[model samples]
Target: MRRVSAISWSLSVFLLSFFFHLLPLSIWSEPAEPTPAEWPPKFNALLFENSSGKLHVIDFWYDWSRGGSLRITQNQLAKLTYERSWDNGTSYLYPSEIHSPCWLMHIPPGILRPNWMEGAIYHGQQYVDGFLCNVWEKVGVVWYYEDAVTKTPVHWSWIPFPGEQSVHVITFNVGAVLEDVDKWEVPDYCFNNNNKLENDEEMKASAF
Candidate 1:
């Protein structure tokens, strides 16, 4: 009887070990990082998220910004930075944590424009060879991102364009992503045709 009991106990232990190994790996570990295909939408990631040149860290644009201009020649732009008020988080208007690595413009009285309203997001970067992984002289150098449109305006005066004065822009945390300004129905973010943004630390970044 004793011998029979011992054999049964050993068998049970082996069965348990086999079942444990058969269980899904996730049962004992955290999930894997998502691929690019699974990155956006799930992480609530933004499509075509870019800082206006050579920032070492990743950032997001959450609001609209106005004033000042940036010079983007070829793929190169001015270096950029900002004050971090809201990190990654949840919201309705701003659905996820916003990474605004530039100005956190407070309600100042004088310089506020239509596009430069309160809670509007903005960013800038001065790239030497553009902000993509491709090498220089790469054909189709600018790869576009996927953006979901909300009620954004079709033409905002504050965005960076192929002109003498390019205003820097970035977006984050908003529930809907936007295409070019002409594709939506919102306000125009006016810009100063004369005073373009300087490619310096003071002009590119801010603290909240």
Candidate 2:
């Protein structure tokens, strides 16, 4: 029942103790604070729909686009691109007039729940993609599964209330090296003004 910077930190901290058995925990009072966890530098995966049973390949990277994160999904229809920025707003690209769903890209939990600590609860450990994970639930609604080895979220799901189709993700190649230039490309046919997004802040609020 202790606070850790991330799931990976928890595993490393405890494992390191076994090596330094003589070191007192008190001696680490001045240890540097750990950096907050972030999405992997690169990722590629296929998301399979449980309802329609369709599948699509999705790719992601941080700062891979114009000073923002990029998420590209490709299916038989066409490729859908979504880009969001912390400082600016969000934008999207698709062949038709379809608006991008926020779940297409990963968003940091810290941003969604600023006061997460007040009601955050650790739900012990779980396994995702064969990686040990730290399970966390915030305000009893949103759940996060972070890889203990990478300190990055491997899965996240949110159920609005009592019953609904829980939005979830299944990650593959958890942290594989990827080329940003190749994964972030938006097709030329997707630049119609009709597909542009609204204010990111407002859109995120509604999407979540």
Candidate 3:
């Protein structure tokens, strides 16, 4: 009887283990994986406000190309000064006729944000225009951006200046206009800016 009972217990245990092995492996506990390519591509255009009172539009990830060449139009050609090339070698900042509101200053290799465009504008120390019309372009696309910032007279420490020692630093001193951005016209089909790029983005740059 003892032998029989022991044999029965062993067989029961073995059968239980076999049944569990036949069960779907997922019955154990790992997290479900996320679907592939589920996230939609996105872009951003933000006008930031500082402690003082200025406004700034911070843009990230936009495509501006339309054709083999940049799809810039004749109407917008007047806005751009012209395109010129440098030696493409290591160089310094403050190059002549660069004609950009922000530029990458000469920076040594291996530095963070070295020799890259900044999110900045040359504002003012006077009680006047803080934003100025500079230039406009988005990445990965060929089109003209409108440099609509009005110039200001007072200078803020947070504001960016080309060839300044800082990198990617910018300013939006004491003339921030939230109402203006709300009305800016953006292209209706812009994947990033679902609204039209408002001309008013630069309207309040000079207004207090």
For candidate 2, write residues 86-105 as lDDT tens digits.
32443443322344333222
Which ranges in model 2 have alpha carbons more than 4 Å from their true place? 1-36, 40-55, 64-66, 75-87, 96-120, 150-152, 160-192, 195-208
TM-score, cand. 1 vs. native: 0.24
Candidate 1 Cα misplacement greater than 4 A, ranges: 30-193, 199-208
For residue 57, give model 2's deviation from the true position in Å: 3.1
Which lDDT values do the candidates have, in the order given?
Answer: 0.29, 0.49, 0.27
Each candidate's number of clashing pairs is 31, 0, 36
Better of 1 and 2 by TM-score: 2
Over 12-126, each residue of candidate 3 has an lDDT whose tens digit, in order, gives 9999999999998888867443211111122222222232332222322211121000111111112321111122322111111222221222223422121122333323222
Off by over 4 Å in 3: 24-39, 43-208
TM-score to true structure, per model: 0.24, 0.46, 0.23
RMSD of 1: 17.8
